[model samples]
Target: MSSEDFPAAVPIPVLATQPVVLASGSQTRLSLLRGAGLEVVAHRPGVDEEEVKLSCKAGGLTVEETAEALAELKASRVAAKVPAAYVIGADQMLECEGRWFDKPEDRAGAAEQLRALSGRTHRLVTTAVLFHNNSRVWHQTDQAKLTMRTLSDDFIERYLDAAGDAVLTSVGGYQLEALGAQLFTRVAGDHFTILGLPLLPLLGFLRVRGVLPS
Candidate 1:
């Protein structure tokens, strides 16, 4: 988005007693944090997400439980090293009916994902976990249900061409904040939850912990 699209700036916090570190390399999540006026440092965690998903499946973990587990894993990994920082880890899962969807790996995968999601409602299960002093201090999960309007094959092809590789960035092959909004007929829940973070609650936790003004 252009600078004109952003909301007016809030006064950024200058006296956070502990540093905030994000345990993921997602630019979207980073923008969410920075946009909220939190000074953040981001690190891509060593997480083998596919393996984690498989384990969760085999262990009979539900969608929400699995997402929280992944978030905690990420936060704890980063927290272990930065014991003094407020390390944040987040994860998102997309479940349509009983099926789980993941980030599409290629253009063909993107097209396939969109086809499966057409005219269907899916739940974006987003979770965030916070750790400080080498302990998990807080975590939250929020779900956003989005219904994709029936999409024509031609339109999907055109969208893939127009959107290019950007569609592969998120689960369900869409980013609601961008061209992907065209794919949805209805969206219910907090905007940030769909973006893959339970951002407001995370901020609330920080405020309660004195990381931000209450």
Candidate 2:
């Protein structure tokens, strides 16, 4: 929410000479950026994700490619408005046994998704794209594998009730950083990538572009 210009009393210095903008409203991604010492402004890119996903699927694009396409699409939309800044767009997809999952539309959907993912190994595909001057400059795709413990119907209901509406924020109705951890028996991937942002890779790209210290 705050800009890069911190008061002199603060020790933190502005990291980016080129302005940075995040073309997504994800609080997780925002925290990841700010926590890494990059002052960033977040914007809603307003891209129709379902449409993009459907189009990509129809066109025979793999889930990884679809993730990148969705990420770049969001970044490009925002970059068009703020051509001078590095606009970051990101997206995450959840897949299990060839089925793709989207964020739950309601409590019932959340329960349903949980049931489907129960006792299974699923992959989370995350993509991050950077655009400047309305053109794609950088992008990366990363994935994490998670295996959920076999959940009983009663347990699923209780988990859904406990997670509340917050479960609807991410695909697969789980947030690995929070109560969702109980749902998993095993996880393999970068912690940040599981949260739906490739923070390390994105930071590496920013450093290479001279927007961050070497």
Candidate 3:
């Protein structure tokens, strides 16, 4: 979607100094932040995500906590390099029952994940953290509940064929914003959050910090 299609609900003041840096390589997140009228610089924070997740799991952190920790780690890493700029970092996790899901490695893996999620509700835990001067200034976690329709083996095959490698890009093996929408029976949460960034709350926090006009 175009930036004009999702204008910021509140007024945004002109930034006087450094531009906001996005500590992620996600195109969706870059688009979302720019859509909200912020000049964003995309920086891929080279974080060992699997290691962090494993550490968090070993520490008994909840899915939400793990997501936030990952986000903070990315933000802090980027912030250390650009201490003067506002750095935004984000991460997402998928959980069904007590099991956590990771992005699939191949088409077969994606199909397996989809089959496991068939007729079941799963939660997408998305978290964002903002940092400035090498310190975390704001953070938020949002959850989206998605219910996948019961799928036959044939349907899974066809869906995978149509989705191609796109399904492997998301933790849940689906992207609700695209053909992946057809896989779900219901989605209960913010659209931006499902897309991997909690834009509304992030913007609200920016406003409170005077990064945007209140």
Candidate 4:
């Protein structure tokens, strides 16, 4: 959808004057922000995500905390380069039975991840952090609980074949917005959050900060 067709829930007048940057390489997130009528520049923050995730796990951080920390790290890294802009960084985590899942490395790994999640419930925790003037100013986390239907090995194989490399792009081995929708029996959460950005809360924050017309 075009930004004109999907106006911000709370339009901010100042958004026209200030620069906004998205600190990640996710097309999904960039599209989301633009779809909400926010003019934003995309920057790859280049944070070592795996190292950070390992450190957070070793330090006993919960999955939600880890996701938020990663978001802050990405936002902060990009904020330093664009000191005058509002930088948004977001990260998502998939957790099932206390185990956290990362984006699969290959199709085989994606198949394995899906097999493990089959017939089970998992939580998708997505966090968004904002930085302004080189300082962390705001953050929000949203979670979605999804229940996957039981899958036969044959179905898994065919589904993986159909999904191709796309399944590896998400931690949960599925994209609720696409073919992945067939895998879920139930989903409970905001659509944006499930897609890896807590857009409503982030928009609310922007409106409150006068970044959008209040």
List the global CA lDDT of all models.
Answer: 0.91, 0.91, 0.90, 0.90
Q: Give the least accurate 10-residue stretch of model 1, judged by summed lDDT.
A: 10-19
Error of 3 at 112 (Å): 0.6
Question: Candidate 1 lDDT, tens digit per residue, 1-214?
Answer: 7989988887765545556999999999998888886889998889999999999999999999999999999999988888999999999999998999999999999999999999999999999999999998899989989999999999999999989889888888888898999999899999999898998898888999988887
lDDT of 3 by residue, 126-204 (tens): 9999998899998899999999999999999998889898888898778888889899889999999999999999988
Model 2 lDDT per residue over 1-214, tens place: 4665765465545676655999999999988888788989999999999999999999999999999999998999998999989999999999999999999999999999999999999999999999988789888999999999999999988988888999999899989889999999999999999998999989988999888989
Each candidate's number of clashing pairs is 0, 0, 0, 5
Cα error, candidate 1, residue 194 (Å): 0.6
- TM-scores, all candidates, are 0.92, 0.92, 0.90, 0.91
Name the TM-score of candidate 2. 0.92
How far out, in Å, is residue 158 in model 2?
A: 1.1
State the lDDT of candidate 4 residue by residue for 1-214, as single tens digits. Answer: 6788985686533343455899999999988888776888999999999999999999999998999999999999999999888999999999999998999999888889989999999999999999999999999999999999998889888989898889888887888898999998999999999998999888888888877876
In terms of lDDT, model 3 sits at 0.90
What is the TM-score (0 to 1) of candidate 3? 0.90
| Reference-based TM-score, model 4 | 0.91
Model 2 — which ten-residue stretch has the worst lDDT? 4-13
C-alpha-based local distance difference test score of model 4: 0.90
